[model samples]
Target chain A: MSNIALRKIFAMLVEKLARLEIFLEDKKETYDRPNLKFVISCEESLKEIKQDLLTIYPVLAKTFEGKVVSAEETQKALEVYKKCLDKFLELHSLSSHLPLNPIASETYIFLSDVLKIKKTFKEFDSRIVLLTQDFLTRNTHQCYTNLPFVSDIEKKPMALYLPIIENSNPLYWPILVKNIFGNIDSLKASAKKHYEELIGQKASLGQEKRKILEKIALQLTYDIYSMKLLGPAYYYLFVEAGVFRSIAETRIRYQPTLAAREQILFSELERQNFAAIAESTHKWFITLSELSDEMHSTLGFKVDFSDVQPAMDEIVARLTREAESVIPEKYLFKCSDFCVSLAGFERLKKGILVASSTIEELNKSKKQCKEALCEVNFTEKTEKLQELPNTPQQIINAGWIYSEYVYDDLLREVLKSPQLDYTPFIKHIKNNDTLLLNSVEKSRIFEILMKKEG
Target chain B: MLLNKKHIMERLVHADPDKKIFITPFINPEEQVGSVSIDLRLGTDFEIVKGFDSSSKPDFNVSAEKLEQMAVKKKVTVSADPAEPFYIQPGAFVIGYSIEHLKLPSDLLAKIAGRNSWGKIGLFVNSTAGLITPDFSGTLTFGLKNMSPEALPLYPGVRIAQIYFHQTRNSGSVKTEDAGAGTCEVISGNIEC
Candidate 1:
């Protein structure tokens, strides 16, 4: 299939996703608490929905994966996925009020992702972007984190773990994208200003430099996130995650200093953060109780979270204007006018009542009611949320779901686009094991990649 | 001999902690157990073979490059909805977790099998590190691949696989080596060996 034909299919799909994202963001005049009984009764319907999606997935993947897909086939393929959305939306309408991300959000996320990826492809079709896994793994200052990054591994092939939450959740996609792009841009600056100082960018001896870099990293993460394009859920997720990371209960791991003290370590502990997990169904609803209270305390008039679009608009309108002189001209962070937020314990109880059958399961869990789950499995897929609040408002009452399709789409697009070239940089550096070699080895590699003078 | 539904339930509802076959959220306990096995739903967390983002692409090739170290530098674990599954593209192998956390007693060992229904569609489910041993803890990881020529949508909670229990005859309990090959803790951001 020509990229053009595939792109056409994606374009139509994006249009469909935009409509759904809008629908999800649109708060109902009055919300119906999500009921598990409905999901139980509708189990067959859900299976049928999966069947319907299966019809589309293979055809859709084929069109993108080198198979011939005509205009008609593409449309038929798209119709299949769209058909599932309508069915899910009908089911999701009642539960949209709950903190759970509507199942329909998956399609919306793919649209946002493809559009963003398409934009990047346009900017650097043949550019020398950082070979991430390779760069980090090969850099003497930092080699443990990426194995495949080293293109010439003669040893047995190894599998790399790409967490779907970090990869696909549209909430994290913007920062995920920017961090890669932004870090490279930052590395270029660091290479020049501080004589290419990235070995310990986060852990440098000079606290001042480390602080500035950390602040810059955080600011860039927040700025690069397209609030307008991704929507308020991601923004709330971003804020909630930031707040969660600040609290101590999480037991986020801290790595001790490296012997050379040459580079800063970006541990997995950071991403396992509250901001990321808060997006999980179980955590979001519970976290909303406090988050809403915080917003009520700070924003004053916006109590109850009956509607947040207007307030969000006012804040963005004011901030974007004030920060206009600073933010990049081409990129603007925006949010949908979709209004949804903060359904309380009362609504939660009402939601649970619908699933009368789940009372047995909730009753089974009563012994552990007081203990809120400390470590929520990223997907909330753990059969027994051992530590989660074992109230009537458990899995059935609270929605437990997030997107999984976006990453597949992203992976497919990346594999097809192009194999990045690094022969020039590789040829310049002579030695492979450079730990014994001096700090000069680090500069040589970056200098060649950046085309800098020694 | 394989434990039947009646025997399986006995271990499941067993009062003694040492005798219990601990599986969480058994859901409809009656429905999950089959004549000789119990169904395991797909979990939300997954680890795909793909590496992290492109920007972190390192510039050099290596003979001693440890894939685990490289993976850590990149943020790349995935969580998906049961409805919107990660398509296990034909020929692509992925590690999927069972929604049920299993902790078998020393007397019981479990074997994972691809549901006959999924097998008809060319999905073969197996564990890389082999049969789940007694005393094994943590969510079970299934090696899912589409044997068919096309990409197949894999949803979480679709009882894609089934696991049957076996009672060990030996009095001496074998040390349960994790049936996973360095798969766990990918969520905690650390890849455990």
Candidate 2:
């Protein structure tokens, strides 16, 4: 048998399998027990296809045996062989449509062996599909059908389908079928649960009204930033807070009836709900703090009250000073004595004065200080500077100055160096890190640098 | 348009003998004629060089010489070899430079086409090759990508792609710069240049 003969046979087998697939798809609805019948027909067709394919295998072997050719001819032969192999594998895949049995396993092993040959073209898709089917079948018996509190689990197609889909390789048709079945089951369960909850409590509510409330609840629960439960509590707090202030402002006019008063009292009960939500927020914050602490410990940073306390104090003082400056004159007059009684007025004034200076002047001073510190090295000046409390505001100010320095100095150098390729660096920075830059600020800096270089 | 093997060989030989055109039937050329196109193969040598800055001049002669040396030695140790050369697997499409220095006549244009065999393996010659000017010189640089899932290893001197030449209406007496004849003209006024 010649290679040409084998290829013809392979093409014929593929055509036959394609026809069978179409027939199965069309007849699926007519058969009451389609699975059993489908399996039987598929098995018979697969056996015939396999026998036909095996006969062609000898023909392909004969054509390729001890053939010497020019480089160009070898290349063409490889391509032809690959095409034939792909068609052969496609025909072989009909076995998978049958029951998960010894035949399927044997077919997979035979295909894997055929793939190891130095053929130019191998059919990857057919192998991927067969592997996926085998994986699903192996895990199907382990699938759970009796989940707790979920009545009629067998009726829910998802319970039957999920294990197959999740366990199977994603490439297979069965996995796609399983996924669709599972999604339908999940949607049905969710809709049923929603209906039951809404119907029992809000019998007077229309479907649209219930739907709106449900949507609001879902939105609150799923917000990534606010962790799950805080959403509902925040919603209630917002509603109650607005009503509470309104009621406080307009008392009897708003409270028309005794029933309205009772309603207000019941809504007030949601204050406890708000507190629980706040507690959750606090817990989240605590978790964040713990993670930071672990990071610091791992990085071998010293943990002391003195190391962090002064920074906290300076931040509080800066915030207080800003608040005082923003207050209206009339409001200040009312609280003048209270403000005067507070400590650190002189320190606040000094900070305000330093912060008010032009960036150039401040930068000059900072540079001078840094130079002096470096020169003094082990001197008392360095120790004194270190002893000074570093506030969040000061840290933030330093960060802003550092970024400006980099933009003006380093980035300008980059722009001037035409031979330097900054693309990879830019790509890395853009993909991997978030720079603390406002769009306007970044654009302004970039524009200035580009103009100077251009 | 439906020229047989004999005519194709004659036309190609007469077309540009100095241009080193080789035709592989069924191999999709950069541009397909009636039924066949010549496949372009990867040249033995490639140079990955640092691009010039705004102030720097692009000297192709220097780069080409360096590429030749690298190819001869089979090793490059100077200032990070610019061109990284790799073999295109049997069914794979790898980027390579053309061996021929194609200089299209003023009234002629050329388009690169992938071979049919390559196209069958899902190897598509990208639309990088464009109108070859009348007085262009130097090898055409090709950027190849394999659309197939499997690796297609390509070798040097294999017909990997082809160029389809077309004759344009004669527009007489145009300056070289205006006609965009040379490498300098292509790079000039371009952003990267």
Candidate 3:
């Protein structure tokens, strides 16, 4: 045989073996039955074959000059390979029929090792072909008899055949029959190679081939067991099994290329940088509200000395109206108080306007507050604030003090409460038109009154 | 206005002179108190008795003597342990029965408040029935749902809630006459005697 012909034959044999490996893996993955013990044993035997193959792989590559051989002198070698293939098919079929008994499990492993040796042969020739054909035919006959077991599950009768004369696709039938024959032939060839390596004196080569065959067998057994165990509810299991089989088969066929791509993507993600923003907008608003309330009380009532009762009534009415409307609930309480202050002719009318406007301005100011409340910027200010031990206990403990400017700005805008008679403060503002009642001084007067008995 | 702990304590102890009231301090208080509201706590003892028929109210009469004994002794024992006892674990919470069986005056209304100290530890108190009717007498049951993830352990004899007395106008005879008459009619309808 020419080198090209030899190469083609070797490639065909490898393809057949690959197909068998896939079939076994699929069977193992889908296997799920009370008789999983047999599947388990078959799987273990295949695992040994797979390991043996791994060891013999480099040696096979070296012998074949990095390629499988094709030559006339290797005929006898191919015969040994055929016998190995026959034994493998027989073991698989027989194991599938019998229960997972220990004795049957040992017999399956013995056949698997015999098959492993045949897979290591480096030649494809006529003499090897004859031996392989003979063993293959014998195994196929045995497999035909075992087909009844599976056929019974399918509710099909054994030995039922349609006449060729009446067949619509007679030519297609012959081709189908030929393909089946060819598949069996390929199985025989690979089996012969597998057995040669198994029985060979070279322990390391045998070990490697054994491991590869074992893995393939175990994979098939697992698939079969899973299928039987899971019953009808094994859709997801089957999908996962399919994916695993695809990945494994792809890895075996194209090892370095696929792995390199995965490595590159992983490295890229590892070298990337990211950041996150943290801000408590709700807490800030709460603190601001508290400060506004304090400032309102401190500023004293913005009541007019003249017609105080009527003004208070009008304030109440306005508050009720505002409350009835869709204005925010927070503004409802403040609106009544603001109206009352305005009615009372109180000082700090400008402050009241600012406080009232704060509600409308809240949407815009929210953005400003979010930016200002960052922890990094406040760290220094917080340190300085902590240093100020001389501050009043109330001031130090107040939540508003933590963010003074935000609260102070809000508080400075609130109109004084109408309940306080701020006539003197009003007079001072009117007469001077410049001197305003400072918050500190107002806070003191309010503090004294708060301490006094009502 | 600006009531502190001392002021609150004094008010609770001395506010009502005509009515005799008791103030029991809970050492490891579980009730939470807010600025104005008090959160109630679940008591240690719980019972999962068979549900009573909707057609009839619970037969408190059968257990009246035992209840009286419990009230006098300030302790009651229950039979048939709960499947789980709905444990208000060390930091967990469970609903509890209030010790107070209040009879509100026609002119006044009272609201229960949770203690302030308990609120600091993140306990929450709430009740579905806020108003105490003038003729009410049974012990009030608080739905002491714990908002905190931690189990709030409680035991018998713990004061889990405080009753706040609010004074309302008498509204003279017009309001009281109608309300009192309606209640009397309902009681008469329910009891054959």
Candidate 4:
């Protein structure tokens, strides 16, 4: 095929990426995208790009398909984006503006950050897709590639685990990149090349296993792509997913001979780890909120001095009426008394390299906290280790599912009804539990609790 | 008195914290505001009864302790994913929770039922008595017994049930944990005591 489908998809991909570009209005982006034709048609005829696009199109489509973009196009766009950028860079001067699409800004940062290349573009009209997604894709077309619980739980471990710990991470670039480039810098020049390399490598696994592995690899990429729209709450859910590296005892061995009976359970340590992680997330959030409360009381139109300090406890319902402030992780608890001096507030804000929970992050993430709080993990350990069938996606999911049971029944004690106060109900619930109430439920609770203020 | 939409909205955001009705994921307030009854999404969890031995059958003569132990092993919980739904065959009964987590203030009470449209589809979300008392907080669970001959899909996340809220006289009864969580776990589909 002439890659006609791939070209059509990428052409449409511009519209989807543009949505995310809208998020980066921060850098004062005035440069408009060139025509779609100019963007995709420039190198449409390249024979080598066709194979890669065809394979990757479907994957991208699962994540990026919108009114202008189709899932098929998204998959292709994802696989083809880097290569297209490589070609674009090869053809143009370093300073030439990206002639591609609106997501050029995001892709620029995403590509550079993932490849470990340190390049900053201050004037570029760049946007990382600002819309927070469910870290797992429920907003887009649902695609479950034969993984257990893929329909409900997050699709990949790597995406789930890294969002939070990495959120406040020193290399905030990975979280900012949104897309999971996943150490892909050295895989190969292109997807087609990767396929060739895959076929050639691990020859001892046999041709059948190798082919299955390649299929799994491609599917995994789309799964990660699905999480590209992750917001801050997505990061905090690393422990909520209850699976992955933290669960040290989790053993998910490959089951080639048996059906999909993968035996996995959470040990005592994993549960403790979950509790520790949950407490950390809760502490980080409450401290952030306290800082928000402090910011609200200190700045802006406030004309009073005396009661405004003590009255803040009465007025700021989780700082919904007024809020903004984040401190580095080390100093998260320092502002325990949110009634800080403006100097102290600035001091807290300046120490933010370790603090990932900003006002924006808290707002986006709090939506999930309620749901996390309300959820009941009826997680029961299996009586015996059962062997599940060995599928490639199973292997990929097993990467985390072994650890998946990590979040079992831990948050059951946390009450659902928030202590009704001047604060909104959701904040009280967050104060109440570490398990979660889904975002919709949490927001609903927020509305319900806020009713008292009215 | 049965609270109308206006009263409901007022109570929803009542100035007094004790008088509000909290039906969350109250997804579309404007849409929900149009009617007196709040449409509730089906919750994620459903429990299917595993065939138990004759000894496992409930009898009034049996002690509550044995019944409690048997209840745990006699049923399997299935979490329905929005991507793929769980199918309930004809004449089958499954216990399910409303996706909308509700927490009524001390002064309010609620009644839950299968939505008329869902009732037509042979899915009965009727509670044992349909009455939820004051100060309840948790997903409302109800018995969803399929009366249709064909297997009916129990899709979570849709408006499967509708809840009507009411104002109580002399309210302020303290809540017992999950006093109105809407199910008797030991009794399976039995009404809460």
**Which CAPRI level is candidate 4?**
incorrect
Which has the greatest TM-score?
Answer: 4
Question: Residue-wise lDDT of candidate 3 within B51-169, one digit each (tens)?
Answer: 34445555677685554333322222221111212334444334466422233444333456566566666666544356543333334566465566677644433446665544444
Residues forming the 10-long window of minimal summed lDDT in candidate 1 chain B: B182-191
Clashes of 2: 33
lDDT of 1 by residue, A1-454 (tens): 2433334333323333333333333433235444444444345455666466445555556756677776566556535644654464455434422212222222222223223232112222112122222322232111111112224523221112124323333223333333333344443443233322332433424544444343333332332232332333433333333332222112222211111010111111122232222233233333333432332333232212113223323332333343333334433321101110111112122221111112323333222221132222122323331211111111111211211112234435433423312122122111110110111111112122122211
Better of 2 and 3 by DockQ: 3
lDDT of 4 by residue, A289-396 (tens): 332222233322112222222222222222211111211232221111111111112212222111111222222223332325323222233311111111111111
Docking class of 2: incorrect
Model 1 spans > 4 angstroms off: A1-454, B50-83, B173-193
Task: DockQ for candidate 1, please give it.
Answer: 0.01
TM-scores for every candidate against the unseen true structure: 0.30, 0.20, 0.19, 0.35
Worst 10 residues of 4 chain A by lDDT: A257-266
Error of 4 at A86 (Å): 50
Question: Tens-digit lDDT track for model 2 on B133-179?
Answer: 54444356665666777766544344556766544444456534322
Query: In model 3, where do residues sit more than 4 Å from their true spots?
Result: A1-454, B1-44, B47-86, B89-94, B100-106, B115-123, B134-138, B148-151, B174-193
Q: Select the stronger candidate by TM-score from 1 and 3.
A: 1
Query: Would you list the C-alpha lDDT of every candidate in the order shown?
Result: 0.39, 0.33, 0.30, 0.36
